[model samples]
Target: MVAPASAPRDLDRYQAGLAQLRSHYEVRTAWTSGQERGYLAAPDSARTAALHEAIRDADIRAIICVRGGYGCLRLLPHLDWTLARTHPTLLVGYSDVTALHLAFYARAEWTGLSGPVVTEWGDIDAETTEPFRALAEGETPTLGSNALSPLCSGTATGPLLGGNLSVLTRLVGTPYAPDWEGALLVLEDVAEAPYRIDRMFAHLQHAGVLDAVSGVILGTFRPGEPPTDRPTLSLDTVISDYFEDRPYPVATGLPYGHLLPRCSLPIGVPAALNVEEDTSHLQVLQSIVAE
Candidate 1:
């Protein structure tokens, strides 16, 4: 485990998850200033060193993030692309970790997992752990969801990309942002108001990102604050206002994001989305792991 973003707020939960992980594989922690409590897991120098250490270590096949609150963007410029390319370790985490996944894809043409973090292990159910296990074991499982609400109808295929909407929006115009052209943009977030969500969508639309993707998979957008008496647009309304007419297909309720039993999505892997009537199907086209 590495604290590349924020420090784990709940040590008990962190330890419990750590124990569970250790039971499956030999786990090692790349702890630095993150050993102390604060908003950031550590200073940029310490966090960067820890990440580099993990990347360069031959024994560490994968580096799992402790949590995601903030601080990943700060480590972007300092990341050594050469070390990452040469060592090629898998990175695992989501939310703010999206920055790392995009950076690896953009800079090193590497793939990572937008899956559970260490702190979430204490309460993760078997269903949630299954996808992560499948991916880690080199199995390419097709995640088809007849339960998903298909917003647009069509079939599209591209490199599966993107993560938290808020985090991805912040990456716009940065050197780390991935090329959205011919990519399947997966997005989800938590706690943001509908208006703020709309604002981020508007930002992406204005940036030409919305038009460049092959399709969109919308995950859980859990409400942050309670509803206010002030007039507001519903999330569905806000989403439709932006993507209702897009040529590419758009599907909602991907069964990922902040909700439990989140499926592990492979960043930069080829995937296909088929939407017809009210159903949406997602199929991972190939193995993310090398044979």
Candidate 2:
């Protein structure tokens, strides 16, 4: 389901991209444009019913958003998660879609994928596309990197959860927010200042969100910059201080965010985080479903 804030004129490009991705997969149907423009803010009661019916009728195995904007939260309350629970499917998206993922995670315990969308589909490199394909086919994909902070030199296993940092932070006060306990919390963001990142971490610490998680996997904080006015803490400092003395392992520098060669991670799947001598590895234990 494509949930865009506003419809773009470049529908041709969008269709071509979808065609490219479909060339690699067996896509039977596609759903684009919700009931409203620029976010389906409180989709009408009828439209809500239509949404549920469409999903049910299509028996969608996977639902990917068109793009991320600011309106996903509006569709949350109107969604019939009870119905969704009965007929579970893979929900794939990122950025603003993080709001929806949090809602599904907390409300229905639904596992989703934090990966590419329509716009990013064909544009992604082959390396990035391979992991996504592996995930969609219910195959476990192991993610590893040689560059990392090496916070804890051991392995931890739990359900994988998390996405864009700013989007995840927006759920801190809401019921949809995830309880990070025993979860490998992966996080990434784009164009955020280092100080702002520090402040958000402070908020997480104050809320006790960081302590409950089994481990931390830092994704690419793309276009991150330090403050210009005064000396500021680095992303590493923020992470080190937050996870210090915590029981779970904390590692950074994974290629899973708004960067080239992004690794597509299946949220709500049992996964292992192995921090070895020279590399960190993330291995999915099962598909993100009951099957």
* Count of clashes, each model: 1, 2
Candidate number of the best TM-score: 1
* Residues 4-65 of candidate 1: C-alpha lDDT, one tens digit per residue: 88987778888888988887889998873335546788889989999999988888888999
On lDDT, the candidate that comes out on top is 1
- Candidate 2, residue 255: Cα displacement in angstroms equals 0.5
Tell how far residue 11 is off in model 1, in angstroms.
Answer: 0.8
lDDT for 196 in candidate 1 is 92
Model 1 bad stretches (over 4 Å): 32-34, 226-229
- The superposed Cα distance between candidate 1 and the true structure at residue 34, in angstroms, equals 6.1
User: Where is model 1 poorest over a 10-residue stretch in terms of lDDT?
Assistant: 30-39
Cα misplacement distance, residue 108 of candidate 2 (Å): 1.8
RMSD of each: 1.5, 2.8
**CA lDDT of every candidate:** 0.87, 0.74
Query: Can you tell me which runs of candidate 2 are displaced by over 4 Å?
Result: 4-12, 26-51, 145-149, 223-227
Q: Residue by residue across 1-291, what tens digits does model 2's lDDT show?
A: 544232333667667668876877655433454445434422445435544664576456777766676666666778887887777777788888788787787887888888887767757778888888888888886776655566777779988888888878878877778777888888888888877887788887778788778888888886466657778877667667776556777778888787777788888878999875577778899887547
